[model samples]
Target: MTFVVPVHQQGQQQTTSEVGILNNDLSLEREGALGLLERRRNEVVNRDLNTSTTAVQRNQEENGDDENAKKKQQRSQCSRGCKKDWLGDGWCDSACNTEACGFDEGDCLGWCSGDCKPSWEGDGYCDAACYVAACNWDRGDCSRWREQGVDAVERRALQQKLRQFQQHRLQLPECKCERRLLVNGSCTPECNVPECLFDGGECLDMCNAKCSKSWLGDGDCDRECDTPECAYDKGDCASTTNATLQAMRKENGTLEVCDSTCRLWMIGNGVCDKQCNNAACGYDNGDCDNITAVVEIDYSVEPEAVYQFCAKEWIGDGHCDANCYNKPSRWDGGDCEGTEFEVEQAAKGIGPQYDQ
Candidate 1:
């Protein structure tokens, strides 16, 4: 016979032997069956709980992997910012990390760490550090320094050194040294001066001197001079008549004097005046010849007997003149009256005398 037992064992475990006793003896089974059933129920419940816990853990791991992938995507999209392992380390002190201790929550962490330093600190030196906890201890970390209270002497020394450094930096080969200083405050090599003078100054040794006037320096004389002295004191003076005469004498051994006797002799010989025609007298002026001659011509027309005989038929014989006979006659003049007349004239005059 089966028996039902009521048991109130909550939050407790029952051993396998106890369960066996309840199943074997009906009296004991009735008494502890409920405990055994509760224990069995607890085991099944614990198993379901373990399975739920494992599923939750798995979900959490998956979520963690998704978060890591999102973080990697965010880092990759970070342009114009520091690409270091941390975010917010770009220009203008933008890199920041609120999670880190001693870092300003709203402030950029990239600015607080790494090679980036406070403005008050100069070139990573301790002397340039600000009077703060970060700067005084760890070389200006986690601190933004102010320049208001800097020592005047130290500032001056730093400025002087910076200027010198800048001047040295500007000494590049491409700078214009003579005209202006470079961006780095260094001077360039001097520029060379041109050889020619722009202000019309005296010519340099390499330049040749040019004269504006003839007879100046080695230039030729321009005009004639009638002075007694043949030479000119001033280099650019005009040529003298005596000098010209001497030059002429040197060119030609003898000179033909253009006196009154020479003029009379030229006129008596009927020659054109040399004074009127210099080209005919060796470029000199004297009396020359001017003679003329006369020519005669005849304009009378000679007669032709054949033309006269042919013209007589139209001119009525004795009325025909020498002009009519001299003129050309057409081949078909009238009829045989002219032909017979022409033949008779030709026989009478022993052939006509023709004018060419």
Candidate 2:
């Protein structure tokens, strides 16, 4: 019988034609090769597109990362009398619990019983480890912290201090130190000042004055202090040694300082002039509420500084004659005495003002 197939139908039949038994494997291989060729062509196109987009996309991603980092940093600081939140409980305290007492239910747990600042608590910036810092104490078991591996003299000194503190504990009007039967003295194992036996004669003060650096007079008490360039209002004395915070020994209540400079106190109204040398300070608003105000200044001399006024009483802001006097530069001829000012730096030219 003769087959009468249409042309389109014939082409369909050819496309759907079955392969011979062994040819099935061959057909699959052939299809795979063709698919591989098409895939290679698509891969070439995709590779070009990927290369073109790589740099731009990478830059965009980097910019996004930087922005994220900046935001994270801003949120990280503890500004509201608290910290950036505790990792577990998210609570903050004023002093940062210098001893990050590992607390569970508001009770000190773990190894330390007292206010032992744990090594991992707070920011851990105060992680003194075995050293045992009182202010910024963190990290490690404070129980193990002590002047260890010392000879007879060193060990005896520690024992002496323990005895002294024990005696001191007895005299406390309040906060009484209870003696535990097992312990020898108060502050059972406290990290008190070192009273080691030093060797040789060392300096007492800078000028061989009172109070040697030596705790035991052996000469090894190393307490080198910083010499202050100027004095603060604390007493106007020249602070030759570096003590963190206190008044100078220069004088008491003189409007003028030996160096005519004042240290910044967070709780006071007295302040210093920040030199306009800071580029960031030029257009800056000098808006200060008591706390954020800048009063402690690094002393500098300039044109405007000469004519500056420290207070209403002070003739000028620390710039005047060596005698700490100033003649009226633009006298309206009013018979008024010159005002006294704190003298950080006295101006030059003692000659009378001819203009006056």
Q: What overall lDDT goes with each candidate model?
A: 0.33, 0.31
* The 10-residue segment with the lowest total lDDT in model 2: 198-207
CA lDDT, candidate 2, residue 230: 8
lDDT of 1 at 123: 30
> How does candidate 2 fare on TM-score?
0.17
Each model's TM-score? Answer: 0.23, 0.17
As a whole number from 0 to 100, the lDDT of residue 279 in candidate 1 is 33
Off by over 4 Å in 1: 1-24, 80-356
- Give the local distance difference test score of model 2: 0.31
Error of 1 at 266 (Å): 99
- Cα lDDT tens digits, model 1, 1-356, are 99655453431346666776777797666669888899999999999999999999999999999988876665555443443533432322223232321122224433433222343243332222132344443344212223333231122344364356466764323322222222222211121111111111111111112222112223344232111011121222333324544555466444344332222122211123333233322232221222111111111231100010222344334332222332243222323234444564456562234322
